[model samples]
Target chain A: MDRPTNQKAWFLVLPVLLLVAFSAVIPLMTVVNYSVQDTFGNNEFFWAGTAWFEEILHSQRFHEALARNLIFSAIILAIQIPLGIVVALSMPRKGIGVSICLVLMALPLLIPWNVVGTIWQVFGRVDIGLLGHTLEAIGIDYNYVRDPLDAWFTIILMDVWHWTSLVALLCYAGLVSIPEAYYQAARIDGASRWAVFRYIQLPKMNRVLLIAVLLRFMDSFMIYTEPFVVTGGGPGNSTTFLSIDLVKMAVGQFDLGPAAAMSIVYFLVVLLFSWIFYTVMTNFERGGQ
Target chain B: MNFAWMAWTAPTAIFFATIFLILVGMGVWEYARPGGAPRVGILRFETTRGDRLFVSLLGSAFICLAWLGLVGPNLWWALGLSLVYAVLVFRWV
Candidate 1:
């Protein structure tokens, strides 16, 4: 009812349409073109059909990287969602303390991805970095560069540091938007703190948590810069995510057709998973309603 | 106009154009039928017409990919499978 009957609103979408065409559509079409063709040298292309796609699908390298990505995403979701919820819950609801908490929470997110990677890369150096040095001083063996376990730890820690704030901020927004009346009613009913949260808060936070989970899942799944900078997809490909492997294939090896095919596959996988998450969540929400 | 660097070829161009046309057609269909009432199909979850369309398209992509990976590169059979899948999705998804 709020929308105008006139169609003039569509004209406003033109700029965004043009932007998408230039930014996403054209580049994606180029990748699609490359995916189907083999390029030797001198810019000559021959039709390769689904050869590259088949190769990528059959490759153990692709499967391993995909597994690593999925595991990393799962781990981060497990850690960050609960941590974010707790952080949001503990945060003061009002006053200057709220602003302080928000600013502090937002600080890590404001740092660029590559910078976060660099920071973690240096910070996990056993020789010089505070965290690594302290761990070493405490007789803890920690060398991200030398050990796969340490590398995984550093990468996971870095990702959690970089992205947990996003979940927290989103959940905070959800928490604040919850009416005071609900809390008051819960109090009047002599509900426990757990009951208040379980009944009054979690239900209200369902939508925002969906957004957070999807965003976190997608971001962590496609994560490249931080993990790449920190571990360089090592110690020996342990931290090699889909994006890292794609970059290694496309730029490092210059296998254009195979890389492009992998890119398409990766894109489709993300799209499919995101859609599934959205559908399932919305369906669940609908059932609840 | 100057898209030579993108290495546009006849087949690729046609492919993308087909996708574009399908999207435009979908838009037109939606505009014509304003109320896209959600329906519970054989999948047991409620889905609108657009959702069914999306499921069909995404599922078709997977089917084609799986066929390419498992069977030979002769995509004719894959396309046939995709068509049948799409029809089923639209009809009973």
Candidate 2:
């Protein structure tokens, strides 16, 4: 029961293409234009021809920022995925408790990024902050402002607290979609919980899990506001991820050429990784099917 | 519309224009031959022509950037390397 291939349906997509061209294409083109050129002041430019790219590529600063960003994203994915799944699995399947759990999960995600940062900043303070006060009372020294390790820990903790719920909600959606008939069959066969989860639940959740992973990865990689407000890329640059560094270059220093080159490289890195993730996940899905 | 605010130069403009042309050409090719049958090559991943094009482009970017970083900004040899890589990808990947 196949319908006719209507070429006219493409007309519906025209507006979206135009919108994308204006929003994404033009800005990207401008970035590309700046990447290959140098500037001093007064809009005067020189055709630097990948010089900025070379400089940025060879720069230790860029390398460090990129490394930090990668590590942060990796840590986030590692913690959030399993934790989210566990939380989702433990969530009530029926009754008023489901609504309560969903609202709780949604609460963290609903907070603005800057507000989340502010909340954590005050919450981690030694004098007034409950977390800092508790740590001090326990005789464990915890100061995000002075200690690099503590700063990193706080940022990671903040991210986990904020974003884990998104993964939980997605996984919960996947979990709830499982037909009761499957569970009945499993029960009749006296299948263990582990077997049921592995054979049915895990497989069913793969698609949503993939989405959760990609979203979390991209968001964490591009993260700026929360970390910026909390650590300001300090405890001596331990927390200065790529986005913060890019802002420092572009706005703070007015080094547009190098910044643009770095931006292009950064965008490419994200695109390449996301593409790889998509390909691998889709291949896995095909295998599962 | 006056476009001097963007400060576009000839070489960068040409580079972008060339990329645009290539993309347009790829679109035309796709329209001409509707089904880009996915083929498993030496890479052992099932990839269509568009996927190969994307891989080639992404790989070429890294190659050019690496060459520029390691060697120097003189990109002629890098361009040659990229073209060879693209050819190999189209042929085998």
Candidate 3:
């Protein structure tokens, strides 16, 4: 008996590849072109070599933004991973309540980035917004628009609300995928809930958790639209992450060369971290039983 | 900001409209598609009830418009509502 292998799967993937290439690849080439060249007013260009990259590397502004990006990503990952796992664990395995929870969790994820910013923008306003009004009524001097600490708090909280659900959903999927047999075995052995989770659930969820971490890290690092909408990279430069800084360079300042260099650097950092995540996760998986 | 708006007028409006239509069209298509209730994932842990589909769609639309009202005018609200309606369809229907 001969077995049939289908190569037609490539056809299904072709459209997605082309779409990504057009959206991602072509613009990247344009950035590369701009990075090494300088243009005078009338569609004229002169090669600037590595001057732009050198300048960006030496710039304190770039360093500050990079530092902030790193810190934000770290903080988000620190908070969201454990919180998402806990939420997923608490959620009902199967019931009408499960559906409601899933839908509610998904609500924030579905909202557009710009809109999420706007929603929080209103939501944190001291005038008519619920959070701000309640906080003030409770005697808290919270004004995000005027205060740097408040701005940072609001931005971080907004991100947590927006993205924690994604981590939860991914963790939920990982949790659900564990076979009932594992639970049966654990039950037979009279294992505590924590023990079963620690031994069986944790190991099984490792793969998806790795994915969740990498995704959250990259997205948080590159976040622009939400923070931009919320803070406009103000009261000062306190909330300006690398992506916001890059946008300011590219569009606000129209310094194409430096912006391009910054983007390339940003892309590399994300790629490098993602690779590290993949390698570590795969190694762990291989080493496990 | 006004200068930026002036520069962005044609392209922004067009892009916004295009997104709106695409979302609404997708939502309608999903609503029209026949399925065995709406299963979430490979494990099929949760499924949307048929009536909840309509409620979900309406709620998403309302939320989208509310967002637009905060940051935009009528056109943006319309566009956002449609897009959110589409997301509901894609997610639930």
The candidate scoring highest on lDDT is 2
State each candidate's chain A TM-score: 0.95, 0.97, 0.92
lDDT of 2 by residue, A108-205 (tens): 99999999999999999999999988998999999999999999999999999999999999999999999999999999999999999998899999
Candidate 1 lDDT tens digits, A64-176: 99999888888999999999999999999979999999999999989998999899999999888998999999999999998999999999888888888889999999999
| Per-candidate iRMSD | 3.0, 3.6, 19.1
The DockQ score of candidate 1 comes to 0.57
Model 1, docking class: medium
Output the better candidate (2/3) by DockQ.
2
Model 1 CA deviation exceeding 4 Å by range:
A1-5
Model 1 clash pairs? none
Candidate 2 chain B has its poorest 10 consecutive residues by lDDT at B29-38
Candidate numbers, best lDDT first, in rank order: 2, 1, 3
User: What is candidate 3's lDDT per residue for A1-289, written digit by digit as tens?
Assistant: 2222564775899999899968996576566666666765454556775567667766889889899889989999999999999998988988899999999999999999999999999999999989889999999999999998999899999999999999999999999999999999999999999999889999999999999998998899889999999999888998998998998888888887778877877776776677566656765775665
Candidate 1 vs candidate 3: the DockQ winner is 1
Candidate number with greatest TM-score? 2
Off by over 4 Å in 3: A1-17, B1-93
Residue-level lDDT of model 3, residues B53-84, one tens digit each, is 43444445445334433444344566566666
* DockQ ranking of the models: 1, 2, 3
